[model samples]
Target: MTIREITDLVQGEVLCGEERAGDEVACVFASDLMSDVLTLKDVDNLMLLTGLCNLQSVRTCEMSDINYMLVVRGKEVTEDMLELAEDNDMVIVRTKYSMFKTSGILYAAGLPPVY
Candidate 1:
């Protein structure tokens, strides 16, 4: 689904990369553990759904080449994280919903699991 549609589905706000809201993602990998993200191989067209809202999360995404991130649980995104994300041309989205609900909403919306 498109990032715009994903935002609408999860009631999320685009914290940055609003210009790329038209980008489409075919799959997602949800986790709070950066290590889990580090384990991925093919990162193309994948979006991350995570409760971890720190710089480490964006860093991990940069390392893994995962370009879209949905920060769940209403966790705050720091300026450092946003700066890093912007530097890497990443999309940062935030939602008040829990990880479970956000994952379900995106999955049902046709963004497949990256498992």
Candidate 2:
């Protein structure tokens, strides 16, 4: 699904990367644990739905080559995180929904699980 569709599905705010809203993703990985993200292979075009709104999350996405990150639970998106994400060319979205609900919304919209 496209990032635009994801935002519509989860009622998310495009904190940044609005230009990338047209980008398409085939799978989703919902997690707050950066370590778990590191374990995955072939993460190209994957989108991350996480509640862990920190620099570590940005760093993890950088290292793993994940292209998108949706900060769930209405968590604050710090300037530092946005800066890092911008530097890394990552699309960052913010949502008020809980991780479970956000994942479900996207899943019901046809976003597949990374597993």
Candidate 3:
């Protein structure tokens, strides 16, 4: 799915990388654990959905080559986090839905899980 489609499906607000809205995502990885995120390698076009609103999460995304991140449960995204994501050219989307609900919506919309 495209980032634009995912944003609409999750009712998300783009916090950064608006130019990347047309990027295609191959799958979704929803987790708040940075360790779990670290285990993923060389998996291209991944979109991360997490409730962890921190710089580490942004760092994790950069290292994991995740182009898009959808923050769930209406968490507050700090300016530092936004700046870091922008530096990495990662697209960040904020959604009002819970992690589970956000995942479900994406799944129902044909976004496969990383598994």
Candidate 4:
């Protein structure tokens, strides 16, 4: 699915990278542990949904080659995280839904699991 489709489906707020909304996302991965995400080897073109409100999450997304980062559970992302995402050329979105709920919504919309 495209990032625009995801944003429309989840009603998420686009915090940054508005120009990247047309990007395509083939899968989704939900995780709070940056270490776990870093250990994965085939995460390209995936959207990362996490409640971890830290710069590390952005780092993980960058290293994993994830195109999108969706922050769930009403968590606010720091300026550093936004900067990291911008530097990495990734889109950042925020949602008020819980992690499980957000994942479910995306899954139901045909976003397959990364694993």
Candidate 5:
């Protein structure tokens, strides 16, 4: 699925990288642990879903080469996180749905798993 497709499906707000929403996402990873994301390898076009509202999450995304992040539970991403994401050209989004619900919706919509 593409980032634009996800936005259309979930009605998520694009925090940044609006120009890149049309970018394709081959897989999705749902986790709040930065270490888990960092440990992942050989992945491409990943859309990370998490509720860990912190700068470390952004850093993890950068190091993991994750181009997209969808934050669930309506948690607010800090300015520092956004700035860091912008520097890395990552797309960040916020949603009001819970992590499980959001993941289910995306999965049912045919988003592939990272693992």
Candidate 6:
């Protein structure tokens, strides 16, 4: 799915990288654990769905080469995180839905799990 489509499906607000809205996301890795996130080897076209709207999550994605993020529960994204993501050209979307619901919606939309 494209980031734009995913945003619509999850009723999200794009915090940055609107230029990359048409980017394709082939799978998803949902986790609040940065350690678990590091375990992911196939980062290309993968979307990270988590409630961690902080610098840690942003840094994790940068190191992992994961360029897409969907933050659940409408958590407020820090400006630091936003600036970092924008600088790295990562797309970040925020949604009012819980992680579970957001995951379900993406899965049902044909985005598969990472593992």
Put down candidate 4 lDDT per residue, 36-83, tens digits, no spaces: 888777877878889998977888787778868889877888888888
Model 6 spans > 4 angstroms off: none
Q: Residues 1-115, candidate 2: write the lDDT tens digits.
A: 8999899889898998889999999899999889999999979899999999999999999999998999998998899999999998889999999999998889888889988
Model 6 TM-score is 0.98
Question: 1-115 in candidate 3: lDDT tens per residue?
Answer: 8899888887888889999999999998989999999998756999898999998999988888787899998899999999999999999999999998998888998889878
Compose the digit string of candidate 1's lDDT tens values, residues 15-107.
999999999988999999999999999889899999998889999999999999999989989999999999999999999999999988887
State the TM-score for model 5: 0.96
Stronger candidate by TM-score (4 vs 6): 6
Model 2: weakest 10-residue lDDT segment is: 8-17
TM-score of each: 0.98, 0.97, 0.96, 0.94, 0.96, 0.98
Query: Would you give me the overall lDDT of model 4?
Result: 0.85
Q: Please, what is the whole-model Cα lDDT of each candidate in the order they appear?
A: 0.93, 0.92, 0.90, 0.85, 0.88, 0.94
lDDT of 5 by residue, 46-107 (tens): 88999998998998888888889999987888889999999999999888888998898999
Q: What lDDT does model 5 reach?
A: 0.88
1-115, model 6: which lDDT tens digit per residue? Answer: 7999999999998899999999999999999999999999888899999998889999999999999999999999999999999989999999999999999999988999988
| Shift of residue 3 alpha carbon in model 5, Å | 0.7
Prediction RMSDs, each to the true structure: 0.6, 0.6, 0.9, 1.1, 0.9, 0.6
Q: So what's the TM-score on candidate 1?
A: 0.98
Clashes of 3: 0
Q: Indicate the residue-level lDDT of 76 in model 1.
A: 87
